[model samples]
Target: MTTTTYPVRVDGALDDRLNRWLWLVKWVLVIPHLVVLAFLWIAFAVLSFAAFFAILFTGRYPRSIFDFNVGVLRWTWRVQFYAYGALGTDRYPPFTLYDVPSYPAHLEVEYPRHLSRGLVLVKSWLLAIPHYIVLAFFLGGGTWFATQNWEWSVGLVGLLVLIAAVVLLFTGRYPQPVFDLVLGMDRWALRVAAYAGLMVDQYPPFRLDLGGDDPATTRLERRTPQSLPSASPREPTPRMSAGRIVTLLLGITASLASIVGLAVGGGLAWLDLGMRDSAGYVTTDKVTLRTSGYALASEEVTIHDDGATLLRRLFGDARVRVLADDGLPVFVGIANGADVRAYLAGVAYSTVTSPGPYSTTYDDHAGGAPSTPPTELAIWRTQAVGPGEQTITWPIESGDWTLVVMAPDATAQVAVQADFGATAAALTGVWIAVLAGSGGFLLIGMLAVVLAVVRRPEPGPSTLEPASAGRSNESEDIH
Candidate 1:
């Protein structure tokens, strides 16, 4: 728990060969791949839309929305594998057809690369940040916000991918090139699992008879089992250390708990920024007097409400706003709308006021909770002014405005909004590029998933035992 972290300087973060190939791989190869992802997602939307059409026109599902989503996820893993070099061709595990499965294989997978498992995992997850951006904008932007079904479908796919990557890390299949406390614990867990699974008849590699007419199996003259030389002293197999296993389990728990804490804290921060009050009209004192601190909110609050009563006593234009100063929260508004009920999303949303004009600003995540971590996220200025005056004013000159999203105060809002818009637009654009580039490589990836699902090789008959035999084993074990 020391704040200091040891740093190891190396010639390169990856193999020299990979570094040399980075140009070819990233631009030429990766670009086409991401372009493919972009188009593919576009295609997915098209196919889904067509599915709806087919349901109407032919009374059949052209494509199962569920199956299509599953396929998309499988394809994602395949591409990750290609990036990982875990398997030949793609990440889709080799398929086997069976009435009942015999051996276990991962339905979800992550690539195992030497000690660089954490980095590998980072690459896998980070690659899709771009795709998520595209999906967010394409799905959520435009005239209408994305439907809940659409949100759930994409969200579930993302969740599955995350779970798969986490399992891969905890299995110790992905090595930690850097000394990862997280992975070190996982190594101990894997060792313990290996021992426990082998405690009984876990991995019974059957001895096979040396076949006739095989040179590799040159047969010695037959001898009785007792004729062999006195057995050399065999090394005793080591049992899993109970102390180490306990320590590892605790480590895993701690790691998970930390992640959950960060997520909750970060989510709350995002909510607060999104629900701030800017319009400065609605007075809690006034509303409290009218309905004893309560009034029924309408489904929609427009410029004018029904009848003669104004929603809030405001002199100028009605506005509601929330802003974040470093890690803290503040709310301001004129006529607080009925939608306040709906604004109780995550913590970040709680801080949001009305949408501002000009460009996108990443909601400032002012790091952790009260008296917490140093801020990694930058801060933005928050202010309000009278009508026809600038909410934000640029320092370059008195009359200057940056870019216009919108603001009651024009001059100051311009400079700040422009800066935010530039940063946000760049971030969004990068994410889109990543999606498009990754998609290109993922055409090969999609093929892998489809083959695994649809073209799996049938297992030989002996590979499976009949249900009666399985039942008999259960009975004997019970007895």
Candidate 2:
């Protein structure tokens, strides 16, 4: 029987000269790297999603996306090694995504020439569930116990790292055995990350290979009959220029924004299609309004056109419906703001400043009852009066207008259930354009990101030479 080494290689060369107190401040120092890594991780996820489809159809991961993803992993490993994962290095991690050989931490993944079309579908999620469960303990962040009225949660790795930090703080020495164990756990996590990220087809082994140097790179050569000596270290992978990094980040940000836009546009389109009545009106849920005043009036509203003809095309007639709570003949009317105010002047009424079932507010006026009945007033541009329900329809024109609701008999204590509706005939087209435009920008963003992060092919003896050049030498192992 034979065994193969894992393709993911995580290395931490503990710094010879250590800073005792630096580990404490490394958390604050790594803030910039953490911030950058946050965005990079988001981009990594987006690119990985793209890779999943590529592998499914082409049976191979896209090389450009692969390099970018590997770079992100490399960047993360260095930060972990410096800050908390192992505290193996004192050197500040570089901001770039490329590997830094002098930085005491390294990570590399072998580019797979072929991938299982079927495996790509489940490897990142379903197949990785067991590893995820184990990782939940190793790197679970922590557990929360809420019923006890207090919280207690800490991951095994975090606990180990804290102990290591305390020991180093007191003795000025990082315990070698603790370092080895932490390294092993970190290695296991990286391998699982690679596998679950859909970067490899091989399932991660349950075994933990503990040490600063990977056991696969060293001990396997001496112990296994089929193993070969480790190859000479290769040159560092080319670093993405600062400009390219900026471009990639911007692209990812744009793509994320575009996704939000798509969601909003889709929601709008869905509502436009699903909520409209036969008359092309979208109505709000009716709410009850009660006031011990002679009339119920809406706050004066002013609509401006600004000569934007699109507004006129986008909106149609507005409708207001009022149903009397006590079966009294109700009057609902739309009129100029001044006219309604003048008609209701010297009369006790309530101005509905805000209207909702739970958050309704009003400006109450103290005066005598109306001098004349609302049904006899000619101020209303459009009015409806009936026993059970009254609905008024007014063309949505640009002007100061107000809606007045009252009993036709000029009595106080007006109580009615009211609803507002609008014929937004152009909404469907507007949302459709939004969806289409967002999709277009999403493509542009993805393209920009790919171009920014993808390793460009260099002139070499063979086209495959570039792939080999970029391949991590640490990945070499007996199959």
Candidate 3:
């Protein structure tokens, strides 16, 4: 066999005493791991963003960041191996980010001391497109079968795992061929993940090395004391403390929130600047108001007593424009809720319960029509009457208010198309402040996280050599 190896190695050894029915409940058992993984993946995204810049300018991934990222991948692989990815083992995965040697599943990525500065720009997105497409089938793509009446969807790896689980359930053994195929697919996905994550500069070869052991596992070691006279094992990478992990995660979450706030703030600024008319009024689409009664009235809208000056600064001028559908003289007015009720008392009218694009509903009040025309009423604070299109502009104030639209002659039937507008002068400044504040927070949070992740810990001592004298140079480097 051709011995080709990639930097990312994923291995999973099958358990000798496999539980037959445990696979069925593995989904329920893996819930805690999945919950923790969700947060870890978010932190992974934040760290990868920082790593991109570091790799771009320095041609190197920070050693501390590299180790932490590898730990995340290792943790994920162990969980996947124990659960659905291969169901190769029944041993539970540890909660820590560091690897456990006794665990059946392991992932190791050889750290690159120097990466290609130019390749870092395109490898993750533009160069990795082909593998992403291939993985779409292996991970998730389409339904297994579909008909007019029913459909069932499953990915290739999932189907294989299900088959193996069923076989193990009845025959007391997992199919080795299926396990090998699953391992190959999982390894392929992990390699792509590493490359696209900017952890490696080498392109992942489009070859499947099927089996539990990696193809690079060929070198045999002579571990006898006489055979290894000159060297000791390489020092293990320091593990990130749980407290540091928690702090990093909090920073990442804050940065994500800042980005979302910036986006929303930018959108509001766009609307405020680009959508207003010459009079500084942003208007809504015309809504048709119709009623088979003397008038159509809006629901009681309460304006809190926060002072008229503050209200004016917030809402600006409130304007309502009405156009009679039947080309009749119409009257539209805004009055206090109590005044409106006194005027419309014992008068047949509909209070618009809800207005929507497709349907409008009303709460009907049963009585006779008004005795006088709406234009002659003294209750209206602001009114427009006798027109094809009548407009009313009123300063916003603190009170319970209602809008009433009716025929000027108090006729039973009324139909009109109306639109509302407001000169919300405060929005432009509000959005600008939001953009500046969130932008600052985003930068600060990112800087804090990067600093924390890249901080180098103090080296304790050298464990790679024995405490004896006269060590010979004939031993091979264990790397």
Q: Give the per-residue lDDT of model 1 (tens digit) for 318-380.
A: 222222222222222222232233221221111222233422223222221122111211121
lDDT of 2 by residue, 235-353 (tens): 23446788898899888888888899899999888778887888778777788898999999998988887633455677677788899999878988989999988888889999998
**Candidate 2 lDDT (Cα, whole model)?**
0.79
**Per-residue error at 60 for model 2, in Å?**
1.3
* Alpha carbon lDDT of each predicted model: 0.26, 0.79, 0.79
In model 2, which range of ten residues has the least summed lDDT?
A: 219-228
At residue 47, candidate 2 shows an lDDT of 95
Specify the poorest-scoring 10-residue window by lDDT in model 3. 461-470
Candidate 3 on 340-406: residue-level lDDT in tens?
9998999999999887655688998989989888788788989999779999999998899999999
Highest TM-score among the candidates is held by which one? 3
TM-score of each candidate?
Answer: 0.19, 0.72, 0.75
What is the Cα root-mean-square deviation between model 3 and the actual structure?
6.4
